[model samples]
Target: MKPFPKFARQALALMIASVPLFPVAQAATAAEWPTKPVRIIVAAPPGGTADILARIFAHELQSPLGQPLIVDNKAGAAGTIGVHGLLSAPRDGYTFLLVQKGIVSEVPQVMKVTYDPFKDLVPLAQLTRQGLILVGKPGLPARNLGELVTYIKANPGKVDYANFGAGMRGHTMGVQFNRLAGVTAGAVSYKGSPPALQDVMGGHVPLMFDGPATSLPFIRSKQLKAFAIAYPKRIPALPDVPTFAELGFPDLKEVSWMALWSAPGVPPAVLARMREATLKVMQSPEVQKKIEDLGMEIGSAATSEELARDARESSERQGKLLRSINFTPD
Candidate 1:
């Protein structure tokens, strides 16, 4: 091939110099990421634990990210709607999901969903893990799990417990508790925690298996009576309460966690940047105190691979519980 003319060659050299090196340009873009507002999708409705946590994290993360973080509530269908919304959003790292582990692990096993969570999403960081609390309406005669079991046996067909949803952690725990305690209480499924909790508080439902996020306030205010908590140890927020293990039902000590996830295919640099910002915010003493006050434990500094493996193990355990109960969606 003939060589380019002198002027043309010089112009080409100038053009090449004007353009940034690809690696440097990419690093810069990742560094200045989230130039615009970002969104965090919550799979549950307002007033629920997940929504509250999402708002808290969003508010705290804005300063570190240098952009406003918006929380989008896409509730319904056992969290499938929110999961779908996250998967459908742009993989540009501007959109993310703040959801409970059940949404990806337990929900899909029982509900019909369009996407596979492991394949469609990548974990950024775990936000928090909370244990479930068994609470009763103020008027209930039972003050503890033992009394509750006696009451349930006495009432037989008349007694029932409220669960946030079928295949959810609360429901699973309720079923296991019934079998282990040798009681015959049935489960009443609600669309979300708020409604279920409201019914229990109203005395329309005598009991509910709920997360501390929503139940703690009522229990503290004496609107609801604590029976048993499903944590391995008693939480600081409710130190007076006995754990399920303490109540003689060690198998009921299952805890559910929440985590942040990015859409699949988000660039590695963007994922790392986002994860770093999230972990920094989460590790702060102020943030940790805030989460603990809400009756949740701050998540570990687990990487995405570690988080995924944990999720898979949680899914397997939930699946076994579902199979044992022969659970079917209604």
Candidate 2:
């Protein structure tokens, strides 16, 4: 057998010395991940859109991750507080934020948030798209969009509307409706949709822009009249109602989507696993049925790459709209 040169022998010894380190390093990386219970922060109080979505995901995440998913409700500041809290956490995929589309796309433009929605957050998956339903008080004499607009125009500032909260989807829709229709109404902000719906039903507020899930019961009971849905198509729960597009307000049609997001800098492997788990959970028949029953349309979960692209596109579009309206946080 021939012997190697001195430099070659040193190189061979170094390679042999480093042979055991690779597996150890990889195993350590994987082991360090999710060493504790993972936490999903919901930027709203219990029973709201973000909270409900978080619980749904937490239930599904447990089976795949083999770790209990903890849902932390840090509601306030129009979802910015909870979102900022999640962004402040370690970017190890153990912490995530589940929020509605308004927060990710529109709130930043209207509010002075500490974190940049696009730059600080990494997209995970879009779970569902819950279209907003324009509901009027029973016996208010507004049967459809045209009637509602006519009534509002005649009444002017006499009309009152309830919103889930400031800068929320409901509020944004109200603002958009007033802007496009060239009419203004008193906007009453509540903690969540249920309370807002209560006031609307009680005639304290005559109308509201509500998510399908929150307004479906009232609509079915005929306590509230759904004039039009803000999406391109009518919600299944309110098939009889027309859409904004059908009523010549195509620009008002916007789907309120729910998505999961993690802070930037999470490892690619962790993100991949999270994304896979999300898609599987979202596609499950059990989950799908529950989502459908809530008046939400199921959407295909996106990969990290796809999510990134969507975030960029949404941010750009929302920026233009915000600039047009000269919207800013108070």
Candidate 3:
């Protein structure tokens, strides 16, 4: 048989080279997936929104993934600990971190963290968003945002507000309130919202900025008076209560969000799967009602690419805000 022509030889070589790459790519894609239990690291202790959402998501993902979904709470250091834990895990899509908006956006700006929020992690999806409610003891004079602002102005440093921690979302809101409303208030920190809320309910602290999960039950029982929600629009759970914008402080609107992220370098296929699983869980009626009942609004489902972009934008904005305010971690 005559030897192959030059063009045919080149074509044969190209086909041989392509054959190995196909299986290599297939193997990489297959190995990129989770073959064991996947852990979702929550940045707060049990009973908190991050933890609760993680558990719900784990349950929803288990059946589809054919693997157990575990939640590991590494609460401390303003969520950096949990983030560190997630970062330390393998990047093979078996580990994820459940984080709030503040942890990704604000905490890094104020604190020195081991991992860069944007560079070290890949965003999966934003699961929920909720407005914080400003609440006070039932007998306090403030009934709405206006009343609260006026009272704080009159009282100045005398109006004390308890928060989960110094640099937490609640405390950040307090700083914004003081800056915008031109009123000074004392910030008392607690280990978490439950204890801080306890202080508020017992009249030890007259005011507090609390999440709906912690504040809603009290508001319903008439123990705590709901002032105004820190959101652009009023939430249906507290429809009667006005938003801060309605009360003339549009800049005070802040919506807390919970999101899922994986360590950077997780394969695109794995990340896509995670995003799909998270959106599916959040869209379910049962999960929707549970989140809504907790006083949070379900977030718009986002693709992995969209979530990654949001994380970057939020981090940049938060860095600017913190630097402008000269905020430093404690």
Higher-ranked by TM-score: 1 or 3: 1
Q: Write the per-residue lDDT of candidate 3 for residues 226-323, one digit (tens) a residue.
A: 98889878776788988888877898876667888778787777777777767877898998888888888888876767776766686775566656
Candidate 3: stretches off by over 4 Å: 1-32, 316-325
Reference-based lDDT, residue 314, model 3: 62
Clashing pairs in 3: none
lDDT of 1 by residue, 40-116 (tens): 99988887778888988999999988899999999888877888888888887888988877777887887777788
In model 1, the runs with Cα more than 4 Å from the true position are: 1-24
User: What are the Cα lDDT values of the candidates?
Assistant: 0.86, 0.80, 0.81
| lDDT tens per residue, model 2, 75-136 | 88778888878878977778888887677676776668777777787768888886788898
lDDT of 1 at 86: 85
Which window of 10 residues has the lowest lDDT sum in candidate 3? 316-325
Q: Which lDDT value does model 1 have at 330?
A: 47
lDDT of 2 at 152: 90
Question: What TM-score would every model get versus the actual structure?
Answer: 0.89, 0.84, 0.86
